[model samples]
Target: MASAPGNNLPVFYNDLIPLSSVDHAGYRSRTLDSAPFLATHHAVPLTVDEFVSAQRFLPIIFSAGDEPVPLALMGLNEGVNTFVDDQGKLRGPSYVPAYVRRYPWMLAKLRPDSDELSLCFDPTSEALGAFEDGQALFEDGKPSDLIQGVLKFCEDFEQAAGRTGQFMKDLKDLDLLMDGEVAIQVPGNEQPFVYRGFRMVNEEKLRDMRGDQLRKISQNGMLPLIYAHLFSLQLMRELFEAQVTQGKGPVSVTPAPEPAQA
Candidate 1:
């Protein structure tokens, strides 16, 4: 895709190429042996469709920016994913965001001027290549069933993204999003550790909304998603504890002692 540098690229996709039958006739897709690709990501984009199930496991929050995207928090710090261990094995059972499962394959526009999107794959991904024992990407100059399935998944993800965009727009239109902050008091600590840098639905505003407005949101299936997000906030502390268990919690900053008697 012809996007600005570093704009279109998702996590772990070093290079993306349009999958053409002529150019990739000999290419094959391999099964994921490990998930080391996810070790560096503390959060992954989540679709609105996933909010209900994902909220059961991970805390769902919105990224802070013009285009706010829902994220499933895997950890609280940079380059740390409490869910994925050093060996790339999941620490426990949790909902895996479709964004992570769709890695190595994505839909992208071949040219900036083109309105049609094409199936693209990460050329740098070890999960896909010309392997001896793997599913072929193409057969008889046509995409194989495996490729077809991946394409279908990408299409579904696009649809979900559209719905997610609308959900975010509704939240914005209602002015319900607010700066997300949390304070957790660690045992034996005098001050509570504060966390910020995400956006969340303003429960106060939501509660104060008119009955007609609330009914409209509920009828459109957005009220549940909103409540899911609100409920997921409780997991933030759990995530922090996971980080602490993994030795990636907040660093202790010793307070400076008062000089003599001043």
Candidate 2:
């Protein structure tokens, strides 16, 4: 929740819950009251919506090796109900800077084909809507309060999602970072192997290289496609958690895995 000296901002999750209908439906029979719905379920400490909204953005920090250490966090009360304690109603601009408002675009650029991106930006869904709501919620509270609200949300998130699989993965990666690890993938050469490391010098040098050099380093596809899926799931979940802790609602829930079409 604390800011750095250079005004660099951290990532925060949005306040949108996943719909249950997205993940749960029996092909067999089952009577329905309406088109199946997405359930707003949380582990009690923090709802799924709260958890996901809180972890949308992945901060690009410099590792000891000068490599970009992608850090993600959640909790931004853009439209919070707000608690006023006198001082004549605290309010003003959002903690989210105007330039960073383009975060979604940046993330999109990282992986345009990402389903995670689609789900987060689903217009019909409540992701952006709830974010705006949190912004308005603390329209009259201290900026510090907004940050505090987010912090509380994340703390609760640690209790909830941190215990679940998807969330636990994110927490593990986050912990790695806290311990000075840079989560990165190394393309293998002469063999198909992916190496994810939390610590390594010259990491940035490896990341920044010409195609031939990069290809030579990754002839074996060091970074597997599965890494993308894992990153996406964890990253997406983190973004959503940011918003939820701020009192946002709505989160997506994956329908039960469908049986193979034999």
Candidate 3:
């Protein structure tokens, strides 16, 4: 028999794969209670590939769906870093493809019955809970510490490219989600990656950042904030796409950020 939502099984004790139940206390899934949620409603999915590409949601892949998709992982993250060609060499960022940005909603629209499927408001409730927890840790730890930690991430990458650095010096001013003040575009084209009212980064500072920023950093290029913000919006696209693929119910998730650690 199986256990409740947040209890029992998969324990650990030094070095032992026991035949019996282990009952680890720390391992628990995130909450997906039936609460009223406020998310974007998608009567019709968008038409952009960056919108539904698997590479964008690598950071939160486990949380995107209850069950896993049978595709290989790409872009930047732990677990299966690079893609191989006939020669068995790691491919570059070209793995995602230039066309995805133009057809973002293809994955969700692949199934004709997308409207019948429900959205996953809290697929990786546990991971979302952890991010909320991490936020609170930053909030309570120290402003200086929090700012330094984030800035260090940006500054380190910038310096690793054989250059000196200036510091960000503030987090309150560092939106990192703002569109900044530039427009990035693919070569031979004037328009940048846009959805509804959102746009990808087109500035300089963020283009150098790594991780999610690196993934979203198009060949057209933009700054850091664009990467962070656009990555988030892309995740929503994937979440909706998952619904269409699985044929679930209306989307919803628990609202409040997870409680801070004591």
Candidate 4:
């Protein structure tokens, strides 16, 4: 299950194995006891479908890259997740990203040239194996109900991804995204700590949009998503306070570097 450095695998997924009746006939999937694996990630990928619920807890932002993805920030600092304790236990009630809930199993293209995707699971995950206490992956050499459900979930996620991609493209085409930064002043600190490394919708630009364009965005159901993101920004201070409470606060007061432009 070891992965080489520079592998683009998502967090906690060391290796992906395409599920096959012949190769994984005896495999079984079990319920996970905890999500300590998510402790190392400060942000998790999100779909636009999650904006409403997710906005209530975590601050949502877009990562800066060629293929920017929406993300839910669990913490302000790199590799520091205030929501998860050192023991990997979640601290309080919060919205869990679908990306995290779908972990240990994902849809992947098995070949570079193939457009079709296959259901794959992490070979290193302890929640899967030929165990007595879980659901079987196959029955009579065919996929079991459990596998079918997983496949359905993956399919739905892919569809959501397509929608999210189009949404991002629309934002880009409208030139709504701008470099974003936030500052937090901790107790006993004269200087405020600044965090960056992300992009956000420019509210001023959004407001300046023509009435017809606004109507178009509203009709597409994107107006609420934009508002949700803007509302979530208020949580950045709360997240920073959580980090301070957890003793994982940033040590330096320097402003974060500008994120690489896509």
Candidate 5:
């Protein structure tokens, strides 16, 4: 079920295989009671289109690397998701990222050299299988209405992902990205829990930019997105507090920082 070797699979997906009428004719998409795949994942990839809504609920940060992707921070530490219980259910209403919503299914290139994308799904997920009571995946040896709709959603997600890629490229070209760190000290803990290993917009460089550079970003709508990321940084402490409330915080407060996931 693994794709071509050397390619890293996205989070929440164990293995991917093409979904087709012939191979999965009897498969039905069942609504699972919980999302076990999301239980321990703290970082979720986000499209530029979702920044505004996602920023309101989760801190938006960029991954650490040359080709950094925007991520919505669900928790301060790796292998922890405070918004979701161990059972994989949300604690309350929140803006669910499209990356999570498209779980178990995505559009991927079947061949490394091909530009065409195929509808692929994670075979490991229980969401799609031959179930007696769920919606059919295909009808009359063809994709059902539901499958068609899923295809449309996946296609749209790909488009949004492209735009997100361009936005990241622009940020890199502008040299506005800087290594990020967040330190939060609890009332009782003498030492603060320091979080690092991510990237964020460099506000100092932004202020030092020439007027034309600032105008270019503002006119092209990148300014608002940058501000959204900056504004969301305040929620990092909030997420840490929630983790403490849930009894999933670091074992002991220390001066040394923990490495956050990219």
Candidate 6:
């Protein structure tokens, strides 16, 4: 259901095809030196499992929609990824979200009615296909060790995604999510660049939560994740600076949102 028609696959995926030994006996999985798909993409989905590591570098925000998914902002503005160059090469040491690392490969359900997910990959990826010199996907018409490892990784990612869904549900059930906004003032300008179009854990709600509610979430390890997200917002300014440094600032300045009343 996630994938739409006519090559409308997930982010970084141009086209997806189920992996099978019968059809891909000669296929090989190659090491990608660069990721062109990520060059222009600014936001990447993140799992709760990656909250701690991802918060150190990227601002984790929830997507603005009915099904809110956590996203690590590679850049504050759209199509302005400051971490990677135009060729999709990393410019500095940073934490790469597993969603990006698992790109070109994912476990997706092939049919709407079935719950069984199959190992699928983007056929357009330069790192995968019938390559002459790369890790073989199959050996003697059977899944090779390389395929086994890839399948395991995809499975783990799926599990993490499930946990992330539950995390979002918990936040919603507690009424802790609120529209997110960040205003960063430029040195020479009176008006700050205000960014919105995302959601964040409402710190006020969290603080005002009852004792038993707090204890329950804290014991379940949700407290730390919420704190990680709240703390990650501080990096938005850093991300904006990176965009300016990379000469990829937003095309137009947006008016700052009204400040909240104390």
| Top candidate (lDDT) | 5
Native-referenced Cα lDDT, model 6: 0.81
Q: Give one digit per residue, the lDDT tens place, for model 5 in 37-61.
A: 7878888888899999988889998
Q: At residue 130, give the lDDT of candidate 1.
A: 76
Model 6 / residue 58 / CA error / Å:
0.3
Pairs that collide, model 4: none
Identify the superior model by lDDT, candidate 3 or candidate 6: 6
lDDT tens digits, residue span 108-146, model 1:
776766768778888888888878878999889898999
Looking at candidate 6, what is the lDDT of residue 204? 89
| Candidate topping TM-score | 6
On the 0 to 100 scale, the lDDT of residue 226 in model 5 is 97
Worst 10 residues of 2 by lDDT: 35-44
* Candidate 3 lDDT for residue 250: 19
Candidate with more favorable, higher lDDT: 2 or 5? 5
Question: 184-242, model 4: which lDDT tens digit per residue?
Answer: 87678898888787889999999999999999999999999999999999999998888
**Cα misplacement distance, residue 113 of candidate 6 (Å):** 2.5
Pick out the ten consecutive residues of candidate 1 with the lowest summed lDDT: 253-262
Output the lDDT of residue 27, model 6.
90
lDDT of 2 by residue, 1-262 (tens): 1112122222322322222222312111112222111112111112222222322333212112222222121111222211111221212221222212222111111243442321122223222233322333222332334334433544443343323334324323433223223222223535322212222223344455578755643563322322321243344333344344444622222111111110
- Reference-based TM-score, model 4: 0.91
Model 2, position 92: C-alpha lDDT score:
29
Across residues 170-214, which tens digit of lDDT does each residue of candidate 6 receive?
Answer: 988998998888889989988888888888899989999999999
- TM-scores for the candidates: 0.91, 0.18, 0.21, 0.91, 0.91, 0.92
Q: Output the lDDT of residue 145, model 1.
A: 97
Those runs of model 3 whose alpha carbons end farther than 4 Å from true positions after fitting are: 1-55, 58-169, 175-222, 253-256, 259-262
